[model samples]
Target: MSPTPIAWQAETVPVAGIALHLARAGAGAPVLVLHHDIGRPEPSPFDDALARSFSVLAPSHPGYDKSPRPDWMRSVRDVAVVYQWLLGERELTRDLTLVGLGFGGWIAAEMATMAPRAFKRLVLVGAMGIKPERGEIADQALLSYIDYVRRGFADQRAFDRLFGAEPTTAQLEQWDLNREMTFRIAWKPYMYGATLPHLLGGVATPALVVWGREDRIVPLECGERYAKSLPRARLAIVEGAGHFVDMEKPDELAQLVIRFVNEA
Candidate 1:
């Protein structure tokens, strides 16, 4: 349980007339890390671990947290386009790996579907966007703090480490704003689409779908469905983990991702 030693630099890249905040570290092949609906990209343990071996970039999606949002940019497609622009601005055109968690995974899937050749590999962890036959993914914005803590993690102690104890007023305010933006974009279908099946089959990049065996928010069945639809995809279930598997099981999750990237 030593604190991760990776050093990250804060960057602001202009995309679609707004300055987007991005956290970056390490070197070698580029790996982009997308945060869940919770946002606040800096404290991500999974990104830190991945940065040890690869150049990792974690961007705060427009309208989330400290990132500015344009009035016209609505829908997940808009977010995906902005991310693509950001990558272009950075000149990351080859050997790109996109890894996303929860709602971020939805954005990643959309990005891959829109421009599959832009990325070399895709990793979706506890992803949402594809509609399931039964039950619905929980709208994260509506969940109370206690409810989020209970449903998001397999180990409750990981909550204090990820969210921290006695968060400052400013931190809480940012968290609220992040949740609001997430709800604004994702609340319509309760975090899914009926047309996702058609789009998923079109993604050409190799994909890795990682799900927590105990995930209640987005069921494990959804992960299986996502893998089955994609032409090049594999599914892995992490036991003793919930929706936020990366936080509760960072070491295990990192190992899985590293192996996948190497294999791909």
Candidate 2:
């Protein structure tokens, strides 16, 4: 297979007096994508698909990847505020879309709650923020990087296709960085907020809460919780996917977002 072409223009924009490294691509309205615990690499098929219809902007949350995490940044809420500031800096107070994946979902939920009307549409895919009534959220700290990522896909081949059967040294190092950041912000409570569920009510933006039927990471019940709490949200499922729906089924996920956000 040939090497994937560049999909985004790398840029560093300052928000709230701090610099944010982000990838910007395509054209049209903005779709602010908040990534999961693991920082996503560029040239994603899902992002590219979105780029075809709207501008795709993905930022490395502070303390992850190349971004400089400030000492004041302690919780997911802090990250959310930075993103909200990014929108304000760009004059995207409203008339914009927000998509969050896994851990990013926690950040997105907080942002939407802080200013519900700021986003016109919201999509949370296999998000982790609320505690489940039945099962527990998977504890990634207890597993190796490979083991943790393996749980995200229903199909092992999909994992091999994306991260290789054996990840490289550089990849492993990046995984460590991701783990460190995840621990910094999402620890103690272990990938959840006690008040997130209670605060989700009355959001003005329409939301699409998607989950993988086979997800062993964050249980499907959490998705239901998100749907139930958000006044204008619907729950959707990808049959064979796990927590990493975008990695396992990018096109399907993209299609879901497009259809939901396009609806009158």
Candidate 3:
């Protein structure tokens, strides 16, 4: 397959009394992508695939990266609400698709529960929100920022591909900013949402819950619970992949998402 030349260009978009650093590309129906705790400062292969079929909107969540954080915003739900306004302003609710990964997945899930029928389809990849019935979600606060990131990949080579064995000082600093923001918003509850599962019951959006088979951070049980809670949801486990599927198996993961989003 020929590589796509599509690339994201960051721009400042003012919405809901905040200026968001948004990266946009592609053309077609809208797909709003929510980044993880570390933020997707660069485009993922998954996003590139989606751009072939949809207009992609990837904005830095408030307080992460270039996006300014307000003192008032303190929860994942708050971030979800901000994106809702961004969708409203852009008139993207017409035929929208929502995709969130890890922390961003938590935000996407919150938004889906909040406005159940707003999106055409929902995709949550190795999302962190609900507490697992069996095992505990890995504590990001306890580990070094790099260690936390390393824990997401299935193996060392995958980790090195995204963030090399010896990441530059700039890369480390970026992760530092992201970690602080995550600590600020998700500290009290860690990563899981206490009432998120209960709230998901009424969400009518068709959700595709994708989890890496080798994910060791967020337990697989959380994905199972999410699939069980939503009115219309199914779970897909990608073999040999870890929590960071975008890094470990971007093309394969993208295909799964594309097929799900295109489903009738």
Number of the predicted model whose lDDT against the real structure is largest? 2
Question: Model 3, 202-225: lDDT tens per residue?
Answer: 898899999999888898888998
Candidate 3 achieves a global lDDT of: 0.86
Q: Which tens-of-lDDT digit does each residue in 9-111 have in candidate 1? A: 9888888898898888999889988888777445667888898889998888898876886667667777888888888877895789999888889999988
Candidate 1 displacement at residue 158 in angstroms: 1.0
**Candidate 1 regions with alpha-carbon error over 4 angstroms:** 1-4, 165-168
Runs in model 2 with CA error above 4 Å? 1-6
Per-model TM-score on C-alpha atoms? 0.93, 0.96, 0.96
Quantify all predictions' global Cα lDDT against the true fold.
0.83, 0.88, 0.86
Tens digits of lDDT, candidate 2, 81-110? 999888888897667889999999989999
**Where does the lowest 10-residue lDDT sum fall in candidate 1?**
141-150
Could you report the Cα RMSD, in angstroms, for every candidate shown? 1.8, 1.7, 1.3
Give the TM-score comparing model 2 with the true structure, all chains together.
0.96
Stretches off by above 4 angstroms in model 3 are none
